[model samples]
Target: MSPVLTYVLLVIVMLIWGLNVVALKLLVEAFAPVTMQAVRIFVAGVSLFIVLYFLKDLRWLNKKEWGYTLLATVFGVVGHHSFLALGLAQTSASNAALILGMLPLTTSVLAMIFLHDRMTWLRLLGICCGFIGVAFVVLQNNGGLGTISTGDLFILLAMASQAFSFILIKKVTATLSAGEMTAVMLLAGSVMLFAFSLWVEPHGLDTFSQGSWWIWLVFFASAIIATALGHVLFNMGINKIGAGQAAVFNNLVPFFALVSAFLFLGEPLLLSQIFGFIFIATGVLLGTGYVDEKLKRANLMVHSQSKPPVSIHDQIEAQGQHKAKSDSV
Candidate 1:
């Protein structure tokens, strides 16, 4: 597919993910946070399972693959969403969105550390910008050097968990197709989340039964659109362009979330958040090598053309011919 089309799909995916934050906030008002996550995971996993089954895309995993998937389930599904659910319960969706905008930067750093991915100075600059941007939002909210809020901290933890999980995913996606890997991870995460919900929220499932039909609607949207479809597209995007370039798309999430929050939840977008978004987005753009890639390609072309074409075989033939001509002379 064209890069433009892929990007369009990415925008839709980010919008789904952004609105998902608002959906979570609303859902948790009537449902337990962990319970809501469990249901979302379950529904998303089951939905993927059905689709994979129909497409014959489901593959059996070996012990090693299962192990990696389990690890991913722990970090990506369990830890990431667990903190995110609790954090959203405490913080505003807009705050969470702005904080989460730093995901690409964190993920790039993790990739550099764990995956040994090369980092140019541009990427390094981007990483610094991202941290500064996030700090801007956090410090401003904390009243200039005051302690950060519990919810904000949790959101940061969620970002770290998900970022590290992406590093693990880089390794796993090497062997497993994105769809297969996502399905396995979601299944494991759903089971674990369900168990956690059972232990944490005694009346969790009962809340759903007591809630209105709109709750179910939101739940399904979160499950199918946000969790399942969103993840599928995310993995696909990663597979297409690579993790760094794909992460650049995350900068859109905060903007989308801000708008969604305003329209749906009546949340206000503050100046700090806007500034944070700009810094983080610019940082992510640099960190992802989006522009550097074009320059690199151009430089490669120039360097390749600058070298004279020479083949050892041709040289050898020329030498022989020259010797014969000299002997004739």
Candidate 2:
């Protein structure tokens, strides 16, 4: 695909994701956080199970492979989603976007530390610069990662769980078909959450309603749109590009989110926001080796005035047929 098309796809992904953040923020008002998420994942898993049932070989998995479903559940559903729900209760939508924006950096670092990934020194420098830029965006008002309030820190940990899950999925890639792995993992996670909701919440299935539309809206959005369709689009995009490239494109999430927030919450758009875009775009480029450190500043200037510019890294990596790293992009 051409670079423009590739980026447009990224924008679409980010926009959907951005809207989700805003939607979820609206959701926590009514639902007991974990209770709401459990419903979402359960329904989402059911949806995928239905798809696979029609697709054939739905029950073809051997017992040994199905064992890994437990691990996928721990990280993907139980660990990640539960923490995110709790964290969302504490953090701001913009804070979530900015912190979650660091997924690429976190993934790269974790891969290097535990999964034996490598990068050139220039790329490393770029990563450092990218973090530095994030620091400016987040802490420009204060100093030293200062924007990371206690609630923000909780959400930050939730983001870290996602990165850790990525590496864990990489280790399990050999044992699972992308679809089977994802479906099984979601099943595991959803079941676990369902049980937890029963045990932890004061009222179980017999519990009274929380609020109007809030519970149902969060459930449908999280389960249907965010879990099922979002993953499908993300993994489909990952197949066209690569996981690393998808990670880079994910840096656009905050941009989408900022717009969503403006539309929904009437949040202010600051000049610092522009700088964050520059740094994130440059970091993605550096991560992919499409541009040098010196060139980032220039590209930043030009792209600021243009329509969303095509990231060359996107074009190069997205070229040719490739398998997706289908671990819930």
Candidate 3:
């Protein structure tokens, strides 16, 4: 796909993910968090399987690929979804959105460590800004460091797990297609999540039948659109661009989620959240190298413009000088 189209698709994925946060919040409020996520992911996995099978793209993994896929599944699907659902159960979708916006910074840090990516001073500053932004949202209720909510902590963990998973996905994508890896990971992780939910919330399965038609609709939308298609497109973007570059698009999620939460869930838009988003957006732009790339381009333009254009006469004179020097030699 063209770069422009890839970027547009990435933006669309972010929008879906942002709205899905609100959808998840609604589902978790009506059902058990882990159980709902397990079922939702199972649906997504099955959908992907059918699509892949029809496309003749589904294939078995070797032992090495299985190892990487399983690890990626643990962090990306099970860990991320488990914590995200649990977090949204206690925290407002707005707060969770802002916290999750730190994904770009977190992914960059992981990439620097695992992939030996360079880290500049600007990126370090961006990381600080991201943390401060998250703090603003996470601590908005308590107004102090000591009283951070468990939900916010869970959200942070979810962000970290997802970021780390991107690094693993990057590694595994060398040997496996993003779609195949994502399908396997989702299916495998859903099983683990189902088991965990059964152990913790034995009656959780019963709540599924209690949801109304609209709730089930939201559940299916979140699964098929947000989880399955979203990840597939996102991983494709990651394959085209690097993980860190793809992650920078996550900055849009907080804005989309904040608006959706307010409009749909009746969550208030707090002043602190506005400020938090500003910081997070700035951080993502800087931390993920977007700003740096722009600045480099700007610098090149300035440097190119700084030099006076050589006249025709000057060019001829230069050529004459060069010829004279060659004759003298």
Candidate 4:
């Protein structure tokens, strides 16, 4: 696929994900948070399984791989979604989106610490700025740090949990395909959340009114569109243009979320949120190595002095000729 098409798909992925926050906001009004999350994960897992089954590409993970998969499921599915659902119940969807925008920054820091990924001074500054942005959004002109709501705190922790799970993801990549990994994690998460809902919010599933089909609509839509389909498009985009370029598109999530919230939910736009988003986006760009002026200049200089880009076909022919010459020797 062309880069243009890949990026367009990425934009669609962000749009679906942004709207997912709105769906969660609506769903949580009628369903208990844990119950809602459990249902969503169940639906997403089943949907992915069906897609992979028809493609004949699904692979069952072995016992050793399941061990790492279980750890990732705990962090990514259980911990992250638990905190996210709890946070959304207390915070506005718009606020949740803005706070969640710090995900890439959190992932960068965790990768640096755990994976020993290279980090420059610029990245350090970006990390600091990202935290400051989160503070600004959390505090929201309340004049002190005490104003940060419980919801915002939960969202922060949720981001951290997701980030930590990313660290584990690298370890499991060799053992599982992306689809297999996601399916397992979602299945595990669904089981865990379902059990939690039964234990803590037993009456939740019973409380759904007969006429509120809209709630189920939103729930299934989020599962199919945002979670399952979004992951497929995201992986395809990464394959087409590479992960680094694909990641840059993630900054659009909050922008789309803010727009959807304002238009659909009639949420107010706050000056602090705009400022916070700016800093957060800037921080992500720098922290993720997507926008470093020095690196760009260095790359430009190298490209300027290097040979022209080579096509795969041409490279293959050149390699064949070189092998032929070596055979004669």
Number of the top-ranking candidate, with TM-score as the measure: 4
Where model 4 places Cα greater than 4 Å from the true spot, the runs are: 141-146, 292-297, 300-329
TM-score of each: 0.88, 0.75, 0.86, 0.89
TM-score of 1: 0.88
Better of 1 and 2 by lDDT: 1
Worst 10 residues of 2 by lDDT: 320-329
What does candidate 1's lDDT look like per residue over 108-142, in tens digits? 78878887878899988888888878877776653
Which sequence of candidate numbers ranks them by TM-score, best first? 4, 1, 3, 2
List model 2 lDDT by residue over 1-329, tens digit each: 76567667767877888888877776654577777777777788787777667666265666666665566568667877777777777765765676677777777778778877667776787687667656655564432345555656666677777778777777766666566667777877878887887777757444326456655666687677776767766766776776655666676778788788788868666666567666765665675444543476688877897767678887767652233544434
Residues 263-283 of candidate 4: C-alpha lDDT, one tens digit per residue? 999988887888889999989
lDDT of 3 by residue, 208-256 (tens): 8899999999999999999888877897798788665787788899999
**Residue 123 C-alpha lDDT in model 2:** 71
Worst 10 residues of 4 by lDDT: 139-148
Name the best candidate (by lDDT).
Answer: 3
Q: What is the C-alpha lDDT of each candidate?
A: 0.84, 0.69, 0.89, 0.85
Model 4, residue pairs in steric clash: none
Candidate 3: the clashing residue pairs are none
Clashes of each: 0, 0, 0, 0
Q: Quote the RMSD, in angstroms, for model 3.
A: 4.0
lDDT at 36, model 2 = 72
RMSD in Å for all candidates: 4.2, 11.7, 4.0, 4.9
